[model samples]
Target: MATFRKHGKSIRVEVSKKSNLQLATFDIITQVREWTALAETAIIESKSTDIVSNKTVSDTFERYTEEISPNKKGAR
Candidate 1:
């Protein structure tokens, strides 16, 4: 729950804090929602990048072991 107060012609809003209420609180609410959406987008993008890098590393390791292992031993 956010409390709203008059800030000149605009509204001031804070969550878990008390202030005088004003009709301009609607604008403050809109700004808060926008910030939340931006944060969510960043988190999703980071996860997607991590998934791609992990797959590339696993594939490279498999190739190295397969092609180079045969040439390393000389028991015969």
Candidate 2:
């Protein structure tokens, strides 16, 4: 679900905890609705969770630093 609220002069729409889809100025409420629908559909159809749920950002970065970094140009 997307929540819309006023932000300065623009409308901010939060799709989820990690996702934010911005809307244009307050005058363009119609476009905001359309864009919201498109954004929501794109998010749903993208299967984004499948790409991210494999590992957390901290874990992935730590693994890279522990393993891949050693093979990089400089490893002390």
Badly placed stretches (over 4 Å) of model 1 are 1-27, 47-76
TM-score for each model = 0.26, 0.51
Top lDDT prediction, candidate number: 2
- The deviation in Å at residue 10 for candidate 2 is 1.8
lDDT of 2: 0.67
Q: lDDT, candidate 1, residue 29?
A: 55
Quote the lDDT for 8 in model 1: 70
Residue 30, model 2: Cα distance from true site in angstroms = 0.9
Q: In candidate 2, what are the lDDT values of residues 1-76, reduced to their tens digit? A: 7778888777766564236343334446687788677767767777444345567889989999998999988888
Deviation in angstroms for 52 in model 2? 2.9
Error of 2 at 37 (Å): 0.3
Clashing pairs in 1: none
